[model samples]
Target chain A: MTITKKEVVHVADLARLDLEGEAIDRFAGQIDTVLAYVDVLKGADTQGVSPTSHVISLFNAFREDEVGTHLEREAALANAPDKDDENFVVPRIVG
Target chain B: MKLHQLTLYEAHERLKKKDISSLELTEAVLDRIDALDGEIGAFITVDRASALAAARAADDRIASGSPAMAGLTGIPIAVKDLICTKGVRTTCASKILENFVPPYDAAVIEKMKAQDAVIVGKTNMDEFAMGSSTEYSAFKPVRNPWDLSRIPGGSSGGSAAAVAADMCIAALGSDTGGSIRQPASHCGVVGLKPTYGRVSRYGLVAFASSLDQIGPIAKDVRDCALLMNAIAGHDPRDSTSAPRETPDYTAALKDDLSGLRVGIPREYTEQEGLHSDVSKAVAAAVATIEALGAEAVTVSLPHTRYVVAAYYVIAPSEASSNLARYDGVRYGFRNASGTDLLAMYRNTRSEGFGPEVQRRIIIGAYCLSAGYYEAYYGKASQVRTRIREDFETALEACDVILSPVAPTPAFPIGEKVDDPLTMYLSDIFTLSANLAGIPGMSVPCGFSQEGLPIGLQIMGRHFDEKTLLRVAYGFQNATDFHTSKPKR
Candidate 1:
């Protein structure tokens, strides 16, 4: 029921986060405490339980696949930190 | 002409009377934003030209005799950064999306614009709505107008603080695990979280989607209802939105709740960690509700202790999956290169999201990952069913449930910053309603000895926001708590 600092580091890695010195240890303690709390769930009998991810039995809340008018290219680029005439430019990802 | 102080109700009347023009209201509000924004730090982006253009159009609509403008025209509104605003930068208080502008408006924002509600700017929030105090916001934490050292409660903290400081007439806030109500309680304003799916989630930046709802924060209960009336509806875009059956919430305010049965959940009152002054203030609020002719009965939500435990499980599980989208391809703050795309994803998220957000994501991923789903998500679902059932049984006997909105009123900014458990427990009284998928509201009931605000939370069955509002309006009529303002 315990996760180690190494395990916490791996979890952070999976989550795309980089952890360092105190962070790894600090997170190790916090995650251990949290897992200990999660361990409380182990006591309950949930044999017949269906995994209820949503509280309301809601299904398929999505916009239709119709083309709606988009903001002009100017408005789209209005808040971009960096943008070319037609594209948002980030750090060069080209190999 | 100070834009911040004018309520929507007042501004609407002036616009109708021709005593003021929509452009003037917009100009004044914009001017106030210009003058005070540096000190308050309430907004992330203020759209001057677009707001003025909307205001001018609103003036034209009123002159053209459009009835929709009658209800909300010319009133300035603010938006929390979590909701998309067509072209406005939506950071969710994270630098990863700091420069991200949604291509479309959220359903709520669309509805507000249709009614000619002038969107002044985007307010700050906890990065991805993770923390109770907005200290987790990657941007500067929104300071409480009452006392700068204290926090304006999270996620919707900026919206609540702005409304309190008269920075905007009303604002839109998304509540996920008490994001709206907690901040409203801290800032001493009214916040309502509608039944899950009562408001459209179409354009909201997803954070635990099922638990998240878009709601209104305003100076009083009626303004909250007005904003609700505008935002609450079935949208073809959001399939989960309820069918278009209009409930006249303002009209419901006229009904008498003289003989209504109000249940005060004994479990929350007996909560182990409640502060002493909080206990006194909640008891006084119970008395106020009781004096207004509602029978206050002791009710038990037997599974209360498990609500937060269940919430932390499900919310983060969903959050982990949802937050996976921020892999640096779609939006903000991509790291300087030399790394693989996967490594870029890691560095960007690590640098972009704040500590609290990263912690939650890790917790969420661990819980839902292999070998743990059945134990955590599966078990939490069962506890959630029992919790919802408890409320259903209680509601069968009582008209409404009353409890403390937060265990403590407003804590100092960094008081619980170091401890995650301490911070999460503050939402203990709130997570149940979201779990139950029912409507809940927080109305100011009294103040603590040091002049901090105390909020009384009222819970109603699904689609029963009318009853909650009726109960709150009746309480506000009897008490001056709603009228009492924080002297910023």
Candidate 2:
């Protein structure tokens, strides 16, 4: 499970992160070391074991489908870096 | 003495008795922060005007009627920056969110406000709560109060140091792995990580959803309990919050350990690189508990060795997904130089995130990627089951498990910053409790030869924080370690 530079670039693409030059080399080296350590799980005895995704078993947690207090448009957009009057403005989505 | 030095319970009693005004207490704490925070680097932001204004309002209520005074009325509490504060800047100690003020308070912050607590400020933390040491904070490294050159264990280092230095009475900190407990141990304070879902996570900037829990860092065990009383409960905003009845956590603070069964996990002590001082202190603390009439027995958590691996895989996988929301569109920093939407995402993320955050994201995406998901994230989840079962089996024979919070006490600030794997291993003894969804706490046990503090960790079954608090309270009542202050 050695992490290669091309693999780093591929994963970075999927994650929408740009790692170029020395960062790519550094991340490849560091992630490779980490992956090697995590590979120890391959030897574990997990036969017929269901993965415990959530520690405490939770049932369907729901509330009545009624109108609830919600954040205002201004409040919701408080932290937005680029916001138009009513919506978050991102880079052009379509050419 | 400065009012900041008073414990939460003591301040509450005095506030109720009308001996000290909330404004006076708030001023004392603010003055202390003004004097000490520059050297300690504990607080990222201190909202003085708002704190004093809140304190005055608390005083008005206290003067109005007997029942008007809540337990935390006028008490200045520091909050970790990761927890959102309405109108107050909530930086997860990352440059990307440095000026990002939230429009709403976190659930825990709402709870504190309901009790009339004055939030002194937001404290520093490792960016996105990723690192074991606060060195990963983009702003500055939080220095340990005990020794300024050393680190305050993180990612709750700033909160721990503020409490240790008496800048605030008690602070709220989140523990994903060992964020709260490890730093509390290093700073010689009480830190508690309640059972997963014990505290609501609404507006807590998500790190690892399954593992994240917000708890109290206090001057002693009793204050931790008092703070817990104010903050722990169910919240509809956070779906994972357990729908269990909230108990008076302070009622569990009986100074006795008789008839309690304490289990010592052999795997913890036998682990290599466990500092001799930390091991000896834990062993001695167990002996003290045994003398207090609790029976001690050996219990095995055989899956202990695999915890670090499992945690690294699971936490980051979740983090990678959780952090996707911060893509520079709806919130925080944005680099708008890209020509297209996809390029915008890449360039924004590249410029906004720090090195450790980038590293974890890359690692997480790799683990959850289609081809590798089964071998990594899937297998890691099954190993998680084994770890949980190990705790369940051990708890069947014991009331609580006693262990060291971390392998070693706080190291020098820059010691492990370069080696990510070694830093990850520092959380070896702590990650299992999170994986098992149990409550764990740290109380000051002993001091290393260099005068750094060591923490004794007590872990109990899910929803059984009472037992953990009782045992820690019993131990603190018999020791003076928690009262020792670091010289400025």
Instruction: List the per-model TM-score of the A chain.
Output: 0.78, 0.92
Prediction RMSDs, each to the true structure: 2.7, 1.0
Winner by DockQ: 2
Q: How far is candidate 1 from the true structure (C-alpha RMSD, Å)?
A: 2.7
Tell me the docking grade of candidate 2.
Answer: high
* CA lDDT for candidate 1: 0.83
lDDT of 2 by residue, B1-488 (tens): 66888999899999989999999999999999999899889999999999999998889889987447787888999999999999999999997887798988999998888777999999999999999889999999899989999999999999999999999989999999999999999999999999999999998999999999999999999999888889999998899999999899988989888989999998887999999999999999999999888999999999998999999999999999999988888778888888888988888888888999998998898999999999999999999999999999999999999999988889997888878898998999889988889999999999988888999999999999999999998898888999899987
lDDT of 1 by residue, A31-69 (tens): 777767766666655567565556666676666588887
lDDT of candidate 2 over A1-95, digit per residue (tens): 57889999999989998878988888888888898999889888999999997889888899989998889999889789888889998888887
Candidate 1 per-residue C-alpha lDDT over B1-488 given as tens digits, one digit per residue, 9 for 90 to 100: 45457777788788888888988888887887787667667788889999988898899899988564657788889999989987677889898888887888898888888898889899988888888988888878788877788988877998998888887889989888999899899888999999988999998988997688999999888888888889998877776677758687788675356889999888887898887777888788888778878888888898787877888888888898899888766456777553566777778888888887788888888888789877777788888888888899999889899988888878898898878877887899888888888888989888878888888898989889999999989888878887776664
Question: In model 2, which regions exceed 4 Å deviation?
Answer: none
lDDT of 2 at B59: 90
